[model samples]
Every structure is written in structure tokens, then in C-alpha cells.
Target: DVAMPDAPARPTTPELLPPNRMPKRGRGGSERGRIAMLHALAHVEYSAIDLAFDVAGRFGALFPRSFIDDWLSVGADEAMHFAILDRRLTAMGSGYGALPAHAGLWEAAGATAHDAAARLAVVPMVLEARGLDVTPETVARFEAAGDLPSARILQRIYTDEIRHVGFGAKWFGYLCANEAIPPAPRWQSLVRTHFRGKLKPPFNDSARARAGLTRDFYEPLAAE
Candidate 1:
């Protein structure tokens, strides 16, 4: 079931662009503005589906059955999330590809393809963990604006993301323990070697702790 290049089919619309080239998501105060926000979320979940599968299919053999089980479940959840957002967009007369999305999401998978540990660290620990930090506020913004439906969807995604990050931390810790490498330093080393962006702060320390990605794992890596 492995595709050679392992790249998913690119969506046709909204035009993919480099992160810097993409415009900011406008405040969701207007109908158009709200559509844009949902579209952006749809794009991320769509890309996430591919990322989850890529991690499993591309590197599953390196680990055991539990690894495959976790990632496959993550991939399935991402697919469903994408469907939910896309359906919401359709109800609003816009769809997933109606606006451009960040093109850099898949780069993390490509960057860490050769290292299972790096893939877990960057994708789940760093990338998905970010969702835990920001999604609650995003959910509140929708709720404050009287868009409880959108807020509910985000709430569901946020809840699922906690477990996704947990899977990354769990597997990464297992790998470290199996090899007798110190988990924190090895994680830091992997991030330094593999991740391109800086770890910005105002972290969701509580949710991250629940995911088993405690402050000790990422705090030292945050920039001053």
C-alpha cells in the first residue's frame, strides 16, 4: 500500500502558496470572513490526513504494531475532520479548495521521513501540540461571535488533537527508553536537527502536560 513518493494528491482550488505568501485569516466577523476561517481549518485537516498516513506507511516498519495502530487511528480522525469542515464550507456556499492554504504542512513529513523519532517529534509533539495551545481561543472567538456550530467542530478537533500529541510523546518516549537515550535531550536534538522553525511560547502547559509533553520536554527549546 506504499506509494513510492508518498505524496497525496494536491487539491485543485484555492491555490497553494508558500506560508509567507498566504494572506492572514481575517477575523471571522463577516460571513465571508467566517468561510475563510473554516476553509483554512479544512485545509489543515486535509493535509493532516496525508501526514498521518505518511508517518504510518512510510515509517511503520521501523516500529511495532502499537505505532501503526495509533497513527492509523489518527489518520482516520483527520479524514473525518476534513469531511466535517468541508461539509460546513459547502453549506456556506464555499468549499475546501475555495481559498488558498499554507503549502508548508507536508514539508514536516518530508523533512523527517528518514527518522521515526524525528517524525513523531515534529509532527505530533511540535505541530499538533500547537493546536492544543491555540484551538481553545479560536473556539471561543467563534462562540463569542454566536457561531456555536463552528465552535463545536473546533472543540471536537481540539479534544482529538490532545490524544494525537499524546501518541507522539508516548512513542517517542518508548523509543528513547528502549534505546536508553534521555528522552528530553534526544527530543531536543531531534528538533534541532530536523525542525526548521523556532518553538514560540505562551504554551498550553496544562493540555500539553495531559498529553505527556510536559514543560521539561519543550521549555528549554523555546527561544528567548
Candidate 2:
């Protein structure tokens, strides 16, 4: 087991994000706004890495140790995601620190900050799962834009994001089992209660299944 002297005593409120700047409709974006959102996402992933590291360092004695490593790896992969997206956005004549990005992801991070179980549920299962579904569409957009390089980047993001969300599935199942709740039902219940956004059509079936979800888990979810 391991521990850290400097792990945060509690969750910290993020200070640097600008505001909710995601486009409401399909609209053209400037380089600056894209860059700003990338920077904001980077800040989040970087903080996730730190949180994972700290959890491993300070609380290894209390729970499973491997999750910490996984979370750290998740952070690294998200950092790569941020870097690639940011670079592509920059190459398009934009840079980070220009537009605003909602703190929704980070807010989820904070909401689950105090509980590893909640973190696993909200961050990867809910958020990164959305990324999984979007990756292919993003690639298509890139290819349509004549940006093969960006499409390739999105392909990599899709692959990595699947694994990241799988981590959530694995650990969330474990937690539910620990509390004597069946995994599938528990997950369905959570999604119904917490999520408010409209889940789009054209789900990534192969990717979702690869991320440890079965037809039983997804069919009902997709129907909702």
C-alpha cells in the first residue's frame, strides 16, 4: 500500500475556465475559440492525472491499488487526446485560450471527487462514453474537411476512449457488486436518474460492446 502527504484534503473548485461556449447549433468555429476549449479540456485531464496519482499515493492502503494506476494512465491518454485536438485546432488558425468550454466535465469530476465510485460512474461511463460515440463522427468530419491527419487523430481518440470508459464499467460493476447490487440494473438506474441530455441516435455499437457493455446493458440504454 502507498500513501501521500500532500493529497488534497477535499475537492477543489476549478478557477480558470471561461464559460459555456459550446455551440448550440452547427456553426463554424474560429481557431481561437477551439483552442480555448482545448486548453480547458487539458486542464481537466491534467487534474484527473493528478487526482489518480494522489489517490494511489495516499490511499492505496484503503482500497484496490491498481485503479490508481489505471486512472493515471487514463489521465495520460486524455492528455494525448487534448494535445492532438488542440494541435489540430491550432493548425486550423486557432489556438487554445480563445473560446469558452463548459465546466460540465469538470463539474462531474468535482461531484465525484470525494468518491471513487461516483467518479468512475460519471467521468468515464457517462462522459467518455459520449466521446466513444462521437469519435467516428468526428473522424468523418475531419475527412470531409480534407483533414486526414485530424481524422487519424480522432481514430486514435476513439480507440483510447473505449478503453477509458471500460475502466469505468469494470470498476463500477465491481463497486455495485460490493454493495450487492447487480451491475446492469444499477447502471440503468443511475443513467435514468442523473443524465438529462438527449442521447443521440447512431450509437457506436461495436465500440460500446468492446467497452464491456453487453446487449443487455446497451439495448435498453439505447432505447431510452
Best by TM-score: 1
Structural similarity to truth (TM-score) of each candidate: 0.95, 0.75
- lDDT of all predictions, in order shown? 0.88, 0.62
Per-residue lDDT of candidate 1, residues 1-224 (tens digit): 64547467884776988989888777887778888899988988988988988888887887898888999999999999999999888988988878888867788888887888998999999988988988888888889888888889999999999999999999999999999999999999998988899899889999999999999889999952
Worst 10 residues of 2 by lDDT: 25-34
Candidate 1 to native Cα RMSD, angstroms: 1.5
- Segments in model 2 whose C-alpha atoms lie over 4 Å from true places: 1-21, 24-62, 221-224
lDDT of 2 by residue, 52-89 (tens): 55544443444586777777787678667767766776
Which pairs of residues collide in model 2? 3-57, 4-58, 31-94, 35-95, 35-96, 36-96, 36-97
Model 1 clash pairs? 14-99
Give me the displacement of residue 128 in model 1, in angstroms. 0.7
